[model samples]
Target: MSKNKKEKLNVVYSTNPNFSYEFEEEETPETLDPKNQLLYVLLDKKQRAGKEVTLIEGFIGSDEDLKDLGKLLKSKCGVGGTAKDGEIVIQGSFRDKVIELLTKEGYKTKRKGG
Candidate 1:
Protein backbone atom coordinates (compact mmCIF):
# COMPACT_ATOMS: atom_id res chain seq x y z
CA MET A 1 0.00 0.00 0.00
CA SER A 2 1.26 3.45 -0.91
CA LYS A 3 0.91 6.64 1.09
CA ASN A 4 -2.30 7.74 -0.62
CA LYS A 5 -3.86 4.34 -0.14
CA LYS A 6 -2.86 4.28 3.51
CA GLU A 7 -4.35 7.67 4.02
CA LYS A 8 -7.62 6.58 2.50
CA LEU A 9 -7.68 3.53 4.72
CA ASN A 10 -7.31 5.76 7.75
CA VAL A 11 -10.85 6.92 7.08
CA VAL A 12 -12.23 3.39 7.43
CA TYR A 13 -13.40 2.15 10.81
CA SER A 14 -14.50 -1.12 12.29
CA THR A 15 -18.14 -1.92 11.50
CA ASN A 16 -20.63 -2.43 14.28
CA PRO A 17 -22.41 -5.74 13.99
CA ASN A 18 -25.53 -4.36 15.65
CA PHE A 19 -26.10 -1.84 12.89
CA SER A 20 -25.81 -4.44 10.14
CA TYR A 21 -28.04 -7.29 11.15
CA GLU A 22 -31.25 -6.52 9.30
CA PHE A 23 -29.59 -5.77 6.01
CA GLU A 24 -27.78 -9.08 6.02
CA GLU A 25 -30.77 -11.34 6.22
CA GLU A 26 -31.70 -13.45 3.23
CA GLU A 27 -34.65 -11.96 1.43
CA THR A 28 -37.00 -12.96 -1.31
CA PRO A 29 -36.65 -11.10 -4.58
CA GLU A 30 -40.25 -9.95 -4.30
CA THR A 31 -39.85 -8.65 -0.75
CA LEU A 32 -36.63 -6.75 -1.28
CA ASP A 33 -37.26 -3.06 -1.05
CA PRO A 34 -35.36 -0.40 -2.94
CA LYS A 35 -34.71 1.63 0.19
CA ASN A 36 -33.03 -1.13 2.16
CA GLN A 37 -29.32 -1.52 2.81
CA LEU A 38 -29.29 -5.10 1.55
CA LEU A 39 -27.19 -5.83 -1.53
CA TYR A 40 -27.63 -8.73 -3.88
CA VAL A 41 -25.13 -10.04 -6.41
CA LEU A 42 -26.89 -12.51 -8.62
CA LEU A 43 -24.86 -14.30 -11.24
CA ASP A 44 -26.36 -15.06 -14.60
CA LYS A 45 -25.83 -18.63 -15.76
CA LYS A 46 -24.72 -17.74 -19.25
CA GLN A 47 -22.35 -14.99 -18.20
CA ARG A 48 -20.48 -17.00 -15.58
CA ALA A 49 -18.23 -18.80 -18.00
CA GLY A 50 -16.65 -15.83 -19.69
CA LYS A 51 -16.04 -12.92 -17.36
CA GLU A 52 -13.92 -11.91 -14.41
CA VAL A 53 -16.66 -9.57 -13.25
CA THR A 54 -20.44 -9.94 -13.11
CA LEU A 55 -23.35 -7.57 -13.53
CA ILE A 56 -25.19 -6.60 -10.34
CA GLU A 57 -27.97 -4.09 -9.95
CA GLY A 58 -31.02 -3.40 -7.79
CA PHE A 59 -29.47 -1.15 -5.13
CA ILE A 60 -32.09 1.55 -5.44
CA GLY A 61 -32.05 4.97 -3.66
CA SER A 62 -30.08 7.93 -4.97
CA ASP A 63 -28.50 6.81 -8.24
CA GLU A 64 -25.47 9.04 -8.13
CA ASP A 65 -24.50 8.14 -4.59
CA LEU A 66 -24.92 4.40 -5.10
CA LYS A 67 -22.95 4.45 -8.33
CA ASP A 68 -20.04 6.16 -6.67
CA LEU A 69 -20.18 3.79 -3.74
CA GLY A 70 -20.23 0.84 -6.12
CA LYS A 71 -17.09 2.04 -7.78
CA LEU A 72 -15.40 2.41 -4.43
CA LEU A 73 -16.29 -1.14 -3.50
CA LYS A 74 -14.95 -2.48 -6.79
CA SER A 75 -11.68 -0.67 -6.42
CA LYS A 76 -11.17 -1.77 -2.83
CA CYS A 77 -11.63 -5.36 -3.93
CA GLY A 78 -9.04 -4.88 -6.65
CA VAL A 79 -11.59 -6.00 -9.22
CA GLY A 80 -13.89 -4.42 -11.77
CA GLY A 81 -17.63 -4.02 -11.36
CA THR A 82 -20.57 -1.82 -12.15
CA ALA A 83 -23.75 -0.31 -10.81
CA LYS A 84 -27.00 -0.75 -12.72
CA ASP A 85 -30.68 -1.30 -12.16
CA GLY A 86 -30.06 -0.03 -8.63
CA GLU A 87 -27.45 -2.63 -7.65
CA ILE A 88 -23.70 -2.84 -7.31
CA VAL A 89 -22.43 -5.80 -9.29
CA ILE A 90 -18.81 -6.71 -8.91
CA GLN A 91 -17.07 -9.42 -10.99
CA GLY A 92 -16.46 -12.22 -8.50
CA SER A 93 -17.58 -14.04 -5.35
CA PHE A 94 -16.58 -11.03 -3.39
CA ARG A 95 -19.17 -11.42 -0.68
CA ASP A 96 -16.84 -10.90 2.27
CA LYS A 97 -15.09 -7.98 0.65
CA VAL A 98 -18.43 -6.50 -0.33
CA ILE A 99 -19.72 -6.94 3.18
CA GLU A 100 -16.73 -5.14 4.65
CA LEU A 101 -17.01 -2.27 2.19
CA LEU A 102 -20.73 -1.70 2.66
CA THR A 103 -20.50 -1.98 6.41
CA LYS A 104 -17.74 0.56 6.47
CA GLU A 105 -19.84 2.83 4.32
CA GLY A 106 -22.63 2.54 6.90
CA TYR A 107 -24.89 0.17 5.01
CA LYS A 108 -25.85 -3.18 6.46
CA THR A 109 -24.83 -5.98 4.06
CA LYS A 110 -25.37 -9.70 3.76
CA ARG A 111 -24.68 -12.72 1.55
CA LYS A 112 -27.51 -14.94 0.41
CA GLY A 113 -27.54 -18.33 -1.27
CA GLY A 114 -24.45 -20.29 -2.18
Candidate 2:
Protein backbone atom coordinates (compact mmCIF):
# COMPACT_ATOMS: atom_id res chain seq x y z
CA MET A 1 0.00 0.00 0.00
CA SER A 2 1.13 3.56 -0.66
CA LYS A 3 2.44 5.57 2.27
CA ASN A 4 -0.35 8.11 1.98
CA LYS A 5 -3.02 5.46 1.59
CA LYS A 6 -1.71 3.26 4.38
CA GLU A 7 -2.93 4.35 7.80
CA LYS A 8 -1.14 3.86 11.12
CA LEU A 9 -2.88 2.22 14.07
CA ASN A 10 -0.60 3.78 16.66
CA VAL A 11 -2.06 5.61 19.64
CA VAL A 12 -2.24 9.38 19.30
CA TYR A 13 -2.78 10.35 22.95
CA SER A 14 -3.38 8.84 26.36
CA THR A 15 -5.78 10.55 28.75
CA ASN A 16 -5.85 7.89 31.49
CA PRO A 17 -2.09 7.37 31.21
CA ASN A 18 -2.75 3.76 30.35
CA PHE A 19 -4.34 3.43 26.96
CA SER A 20 -4.86 5.32 23.68
CA TYR A 21 -6.54 4.66 20.36
CA GLU A 22 -6.29 5.69 16.74
CA PHE A 23 -9.20 6.65 14.55
CA GLU A 24 -9.59 5.05 11.16
CA GLU A 25 -11.70 6.20 8.25
CA GLU A 26 -14.46 3.93 7.18
CA GLU A 27 -15.29 2.89 3.63
CA THR A 28 -18.41 4.22 1.98
CA PRO A 29 -20.99 1.80 0.66
CA GLU A 30 -22.02 1.78 -2.99
CA THR A 31 -25.19 3.58 -3.99
CA LEU A 32 -28.16 1.65 -5.31
CA ASP A 33 -30.06 2.32 -8.53
CA PRO A 34 -33.34 4.25 -8.75
CA LYS A 35 -35.30 1.24 -9.95
CA ASN A 36 -34.20 -0.74 -6.93
CA GLN A 37 -34.98 2.18 -4.61
CA LEU A 38 -38.29 2.84 -2.93
CA LEU A 39 -39.40 6.47 -2.83
CA TYR A 40 -42.26 8.34 -1.21
CA VAL A 41 -43.87 11.63 -2.17
CA LEU A 42 -45.49 13.56 0.64
CA LEU A 43 -46.81 17.05 1.26
CA ASP A 44 -45.15 18.98 4.04
CA LYS A 45 -46.00 22.46 5.25
CA LYS A 46 -44.68 22.52 8.75
CA GLN A 47 -41.78 24.79 9.76
CA ARG A 48 -41.63 26.37 6.34
CA ALA A 49 -42.84 29.88 7.10
CA GLY A 50 -46.35 29.08 5.80
CA LYS A 51 -45.00 27.70 2.53
CA GLU A 52 -45.87 24.21 1.30
CA VAL A 53 -43.13 21.87 0.07
CA THR A 54 -43.27 18.46 -1.50
CA LEU A 55 -40.87 15.95 -0.04
CA ILE A 56 -39.57 12.84 -1.74
CA GLU A 57 -37.97 10.42 0.66
CA GLY A 58 -36.63 6.84 0.93
CA PHE A 59 -33.90 7.30 -1.68
CA ILE A 60 -30.88 5.03 -1.45
CA GLY A 61 -28.36 6.32 -3.96
CA SER A 62 -25.38 8.58 -4.46
CA ASP A 63 -25.43 12.33 -3.88
CA GLU A 64 -24.96 12.96 -7.58
CA ASP A 65 -28.05 10.92 -8.46
CA LEU A 66 -30.06 12.62 -5.73
CA LYS A 67 -29.03 16.03 -7.01
CA ASP A 68 -29.88 15.02 -10.55
CA LEU A 69 -33.38 13.92 -9.48
CA GLY A 70 -33.86 17.08 -7.46
CA LYS A 71 -32.85 19.22 -10.44
CA LEU A 72 -35.17 17.32 -12.72
CA LEU A 73 -38.11 17.66 -10.34
CA LYS A 74 -37.47 21.36 -9.78
CA SER A 75 -37.18 21.98 -13.53
CA LYS A 76 -40.34 20.03 -14.28
CA CYS A 77 -42.26 21.85 -11.57
CA GLY A 78 -40.67 25.20 -12.40
CA VAL A 79 -39.65 25.71 -8.81
CA GLY A 80 -36.62 25.48 -6.55
CA GLY A 81 -35.72 23.21 -3.66
CA THR A 82 -32.92 21.19 -2.10
CA ALA A 83 -31.70 17.61 -2.07
CA LYS A 84 -29.85 16.33 0.97
CA ASP A 85 -29.86 13.62 3.63
CA GLY A 86 -31.31 11.10 1.19
CA GLU A 87 -34.42 13.19 0.63
CA ILE A 88 -35.50 15.54 -2.14
CA VAL A 89 -37.50 18.60 -1.22
CA ILE A 90 -39.47 20.28 -3.97
CA GLN A 91 -41.06 23.66 -3.53
CA GLY A 92 -44.85 23.90 -3.37
CA SER A 93 -47.41 21.15 -2.81
CA PHE A 94 -47.00 19.19 -6.02
CA ARG A 95 -47.58 15.74 -4.64
CA ASP A 96 -49.42 14.43 -7.70
CA LYS A 97 -46.98 15.91 -10.12
CA VAL A 98 -44.03 14.63 -8.13
CA ILE A 99 -45.50 11.15 -8.07
CA GLU A 100 -46.07 11.26 -11.80
CA LEU A 101 -42.51 12.31 -12.44
CA LEU A 102 -41.02 9.71 -10.15
CA THR A 103 -43.17 6.91 -11.53
CA LYS A 104 -42.10 7.80 -15.05
CA GLU A 105 -38.51 7.46 -13.98
CA GLY A 106 -38.99 3.76 -13.13
CA TYR A 107 -38.98 4.32 -9.38
CA LYS A 108 -41.38 2.73 -6.92
CA THR A 109 -43.25 5.65 -5.35
CA LYS A 110 -45.88 5.91 -2.66
CA ARG A 111 -47.93 8.89 -1.51
CA LYS A 112 -48.02 9.60 2.17
CA GLY A 113 -49.94 12.16 4.26
CA GLY A 114 -52.98 14.04 3.04
Candidate 3:
Protein backbone atom coordinates (compact mmCIF):
# COMPACT_ATOMS: atom_id res chain seq x y z
CA MET A 1 0.00 0.00 0.00
CA SER A 2 1.17 3.52 -0.80
CA LYS A 3 1.89 5.59 2.35
CA ASN A 4 1.59 8.92 0.58
CA LYS A 5 -1.92 10.29 0.20
CA LYS A 6 -3.10 11.53 -3.15
CA GLU A 7 -3.37 15.30 -3.66
CA LYS A 8 -6.77 16.71 -2.73
CA LEU A 9 -8.96 17.96 -5.54
CA ASN A 10 -10.06 20.98 -3.52
CA VAL A 11 -8.08 23.10 -1.08
CA VAL A 12 -11.04 23.64 1.26
CA TYR A 13 -13.83 21.35 2.35
CA SER A 14 -17.35 22.58 3.17
CA THR A 15 -20.30 20.82 4.80
CA ASN A 16 -22.73 22.52 2.42
CA PRO A 17 -23.16 20.69 -0.86
CA ASN A 18 -23.50 23.91 -2.87
CA PHE A 19 -20.15 25.23 -1.59
CA SER A 20 -17.13 25.19 -3.87
CA TYR A 21 -13.52 26.09 -3.26
CA GLU A 22 -11.35 28.30 -5.47
CA PHE A 23 -7.71 29.16 -4.89
CA GLU A 24 -6.15 32.49 -5.73
CA GLU A 25 -2.44 33.03 -6.11
CA GLU A 26 -0.73 35.97 -4.44
CA GLU A 27 1.55 38.05 -6.61
CA THR A 28 5.12 38.84 -5.62
CA PRO A 29 6.07 42.51 -5.36
CA GLU A 30 8.51 43.78 -7.98
CA THR A 31 11.94 45.13 -7.09
CA LEU A 32 12.70 48.61 -8.41
CA ASP A 33 15.93 50.52 -8.82
CA PRO A 34 16.44 53.66 -6.74
CA LYS A 35 18.17 55.49 -9.56
CA ASN A 36 15.35 54.96 -12.06
CA GLN A 37 12.73 56.38 -9.72
CA LEU A 38 12.21 59.98 -8.59
CA LEU A 39 10.90 60.46 -5.07
CA TYR A 40 9.17 63.60 -3.82
CA VAL A 41 9.51 64.89 -0.29
CA LEU A 42 6.73 67.14 0.92
CA LEU A 43 5.50 68.54 4.21
CA ASP A 44 1.82 68.11 5.02
CA LYS A 45 -0.46 68.66 7.99
CA LYS A 46 -3.82 69.34 6.43
CA GLN A 47 -5.77 66.26 7.54
CA ARG A 48 -3.47 64.67 10.07
CA ALA A 49 -5.40 65.58 13.26
CA GLY A 50 -3.34 68.81 13.52
CA LYS A 51 0.02 67.02 13.54
CA GLU A 52 2.75 67.65 10.99
CA VAL A 53 4.03 64.88 8.73
CA THR A 54 6.55 64.47 5.98
CA LEU A 55 5.18 62.78 2.88
CA ILE A 56 7.38 60.78 0.49
CA GLU A 57 5.74 60.00 -2.82
CA GLY A 58 6.46 58.75 -6.34
CA PHE A 59 7.98 55.44 -5.26
CA ILE A 60 7.66 52.75 -7.88
CA GLY A 61 7.62 49.04 -7.13
CA SER A 62 6.53 46.83 -4.27
CA ASP A 63 4.59 47.82 -1.15
CA GLU A 64 7.02 45.83 0.98
CA ASP A 65 9.91 47.98 -0.23
CA LEU A 66 7.89 51.08 0.57
CA LYS A 67 7.22 49.84 4.08
CA ASP A 68 10.90 49.00 4.62
CA LEU A 69 11.93 52.45 3.41
CA GLY A 70 9.29 53.99 5.66
CA LYS A 71 10.67 52.10 8.66
CA LEU A 72 14.17 53.29 7.86
CA LEU A 73 13.02 56.89 7.54
CA LYS A 74 11.04 56.72 10.77
CA SER A 75 14.04 55.34 12.61
CA LYS A 76 16.34 57.97 11.12
CA CYS A 77 13.93 60.78 11.98
CA GLY A 78 13.19 59.32 15.42
CA VAL A 79 9.42 59.39 14.79
CA GLY A 80 6.46 57.21 13.84
CA GLY A 81 4.35 56.96 10.69
CA THR A 82 2.84 54.68 8.05
CA ALA A 83 3.53 53.57 4.51
CA LYS A 84 0.54 53.05 2.20
CA ASP A 85 -0.86 53.87 -1.22
CA GLY A 86 2.70 53.98 -2.53
CA GLU A 87 3.54 56.82 -0.16
CA ILE A 88 5.57 57.03 3.05
CA VAL A 89 4.28 59.33 5.80
CA ILE A 90 6.63 60.22 8.62
CA GLN A 91 5.17 61.89 11.68
CA GLY A 92 7.20 65.12 11.57
CA SER A 93 8.41 67.89 9.31
CA PHE A 94 11.69 66.20 8.45
CA ARG A 95 11.64 67.18 4.81
CA ASP A 96 15.22 68.44 4.53
CA LYS A 97 16.69 65.65 6.60
CA VAL A 98 14.66 63.03 4.79
CA ILE A 99 15.84 64.41 1.43
CA GLU A 100 19.40 64.34 2.56
CA LEU A 101 19.21 60.79 3.81
CA LEU A 102 17.39 59.52 0.74
CA THR A 103 19.88 61.26 -1.53
CA LYS A 104 22.72 59.66 0.40
CA GLU A 105 21.01 56.30 -0.11
CA GLY A 106 21.21 56.84 -3.90
CA TYR A 107 17.57 57.77 -4.42
CA LYS A 108 16.59 60.65 -6.65
CA THR A 109 15.08 62.91 -4.02
CA LYS A 110 13.18 66.14 -4.71
CA ARG A 111 11.51 68.70 -2.47
CA LYS A 112 8.04 69.52 -3.66
CA GLY A 113 5.40 72.08 -2.57
CA GLY A 114 6.94 75.07 -0.84
Candidate 4:
Protein backbone atom coordinates (compact mmCIF):
# COMPACT_ATOMS: atom_id res chain seq x y z
CA MET A 1 0.00 0.00 0.00
CA SER A 2 2.88 2.38 0.83
CA LYS A 3 5.63 3.45 -1.62
CA ASN A 4 8.20 1.06 -0.17
CA LYS A 5 5.75 -1.81 -0.21
CA LYS A 6 4.90 -1.14 -3.85
CA GLU A 7 8.56 -1.60 -4.83
CA LYS A 8 8.68 -5.19 -3.65
CA LEU A 9 5.81 -6.31 -5.90
CA ASN A 10 7.42 -9.65 -6.72
CA VAL A 11 7.25 -10.97 -3.19
CA VAL A 12 3.77 -11.21 -1.71
CA TYR A 13 5.10 -12.74 1.48
CA SER A 14 8.51 -13.65 2.88
CA THR A 15 9.11 -16.62 5.13
CA ASN A 16 12.19 -15.11 6.79
CA PRO A 17 11.44 -12.37 9.30
CA ASN A 18 14.80 -10.73 8.45
CA PHE A 19 14.09 -10.59 4.73
CA SER A 20 14.96 -7.31 2.95
CA TYR A 21 14.45 -6.08 -0.57
CA GLU A 22 17.51 -5.16 -2.58
CA PHE A 23 16.96 -2.46 -5.15
CA GLU A 24 19.29 -2.35 -8.11
CA GLU A 25 20.53 1.09 -9.12
CA GLU A 26 21.42 1.89 -12.69
CA GLU A 27 24.96 3.06 -13.27
CA THR A 28 25.84 5.86 -15.65
CA PRO A 29 28.57 5.22 -18.19
CA GLU A 30 31.95 6.85 -17.67
CA THR A 31 32.67 9.97 -19.66
CA LEU A 32 34.93 9.34 -22.62
CA ASP A 33 37.99 11.40 -23.45
CA PRO A 34 37.29 14.42 -25.63
CA LYS A 35 39.58 13.40 -28.47
CA ASN A 36 38.08 9.93 -28.56
CA GLN A 37 34.45 11.12 -28.75
CA LEU A 38 32.88 11.78 -32.11
CA LEU A 39 30.15 14.45 -31.77
CA TYR A 40 27.75 15.62 -34.43
CA VAL A 41 26.78 19.30 -34.66
CA LEU A 42 23.60 20.09 -36.56
CA LEU A 43 20.95 22.74 -37.11
CA ASP A 44 17.32 21.79 -36.44
CA LYS A 45 14.02 23.72 -36.75
CA LYS A 46 11.30 21.17 -37.31
CA GLN A 47 9.25 21.49 -34.12
CA ARG A 48 10.43 24.77 -32.68
CA ALA A 49 8.00 27.21 -34.33
CA GLY A 50 10.56 27.79 -37.12
CA LYS A 51 13.28 28.82 -34.73
CA GLU A 52 16.64 27.16 -35.23
CA VAL A 53 18.69 25.29 -32.67
CA THR A 54 22.09 23.71 -32.83
CA LEU A 55 22.09 20.11 -31.69
CA ILE A 56 25.17 18.20 -30.58
CA GLU A 57 24.71 14.45 -30.49
CA GLY A 58 26.64 11.16 -30.19
CA PHE A 59 28.07 11.94 -26.78
CA ILE A 60 28.73 8.85 -24.69
CA GLY A 61 29.10 9.92 -21.10
CA SER A 62 27.45 10.62 -17.78
CA ASP A 63 24.74 13.27 -17.43
CA GLU A 64 26.95 15.52 -15.36
CA ASP A 65 29.62 15.65 -18.01
CA LEU A 66 27.00 16.33 -20.67
CA LYS A 67 25.58 19.22 -18.62
CA ASP A 68 29.05 20.65 -18.11
CA LEU A 69 29.75 20.54 -21.83
CA GLY A 70 26.38 22.14 -22.54
CA LYS A 71 27.08 24.87 -20.03
CA LEU A 72 30.43 25.60 -21.59
CA LEU A 73 28.96 25.77 -25.07
CA LYS A 74 26.08 27.99 -24.00
CA SER A 75 28.39 30.41 -22.22
CA LYS A 76 30.81 30.61 -25.13
CA CYS A 77 27.99 31.14 -27.61
CA GLY A 78 26.10 33.53 -25.31
CA VAL A 79 22.88 31.52 -25.66
CA GLY A 80 20.51 29.41 -23.58
CA GLY A 81 19.89 25.68 -23.97
CA THR A 82 19.71 22.30 -22.30
CA ALA A 83 21.59 19.02 -22.13
CA LYS A 84 19.67 15.77 -21.76
CA ASP A 85 19.12 12.32 -23.28
CA GLY A 86 22.74 12.23 -24.51
CA GLU A 87 22.21 15.34 -26.61
CA ILE A 88 23.02 19.04 -26.15
CA VAL A 89 20.66 21.61 -27.61
CA ILE A 90 21.90 25.14 -28.04
CA GLN A 91 19.33 27.93 -28.51
CA GLY A 92 20.25 29.03 -32.01
CA SER A 93 21.65 27.99 -35.35
CA PHE A 94 25.32 28.00 -34.49
CA ARG A 95 26.50 24.75 -35.95
CA ASP A 96 29.90 26.08 -37.13
CA LYS A 97 30.55 27.82 -33.84
CA VAL A 98 29.58 24.77 -31.85
CA ILE A 99 31.87 22.59 -33.93
CA GLU A 100 34.73 25.04 -33.42
CA LEU A 101 34.19 25.17 -29.69
CA LEU A 102 34.04 21.38 -29.43
CA THR A 103 37.21 21.14 -31.49
CA LYS A 104 38.96 23.60 -29.21
CA GLU A 105 37.98 21.39 -26.30
CA GLY A 106 39.69 18.44 -28.09
CA TYR A 107 36.46 16.75 -29.19
CA LYS A 108 36.16 15.21 -32.65
CA THR A 109 33.24 17.01 -34.34
CA LYS A 110 31.38 16.67 -37.62
CA ARG A 111 28.84 19.12 -39.06
CA LYS A 112 25.52 17.64 -40.11
CA GLY A 113 22.02 18.43 -41.49
CA GLY A 114 23.05 21.61 -43.29
TM-scores, each model vs. reference: 0.55, 0.76, 0.76, 0.84
Alpha carbon lDDT at 43, candidate 3: 94
lDDT of each residue in 1-114, candidate 4, tens digit only: 245755664687889989987654558899999989999999999889999999999999999999999999999999999999999999988898898999999999988865
Better of 1 and 2 by lDDT: 2
Q: In lDDT terms, which candidate is top? A: 4
Candidate 2 structure quality by residue, lDDT tens digits, 1-114: 243324647744458866644546655456787688889889988899989999999988677788898999999999999999889999898999989998898988998987
Please list the residue runs of candidate 2 whose C-alpha ends up more than 4 Å from where it truly belongs after superposition: 1-26
lDDT, candidate 3, 1-114, per-residue tens: 232223334554568888764544446668678888899999998977988899999998888899999999999999999999899999888999999999988899889999
Residue pairs in collision within model 4: none
User: Between 3 and 4, whose TM-score is larger?
Assistant: 4
Q: How accurate locally is residue 27 in candidate 4, as Cα lDDT from 0 to 100?
A: 84
- Stretches of candidate 3 exceeding 4 Å from the true structure: 1-26
lDDT score of residue 111 within candidate 3: 90
Model 1, range 4-56, lDDT digits (tens) per residue?
A: 43334233554765542222223434333434656655454455676545444
What does candidate 1 score on TM? 0.55
Residue 63: error of model 2 in Å? 1.1
Q: What is the lDDT of residue 42 in candidate 2?
A: 95
Query: What's the CA RMSD of model 3 in angstroms?
Result: 7.9
Candidate 2 residue pairs that clash: none
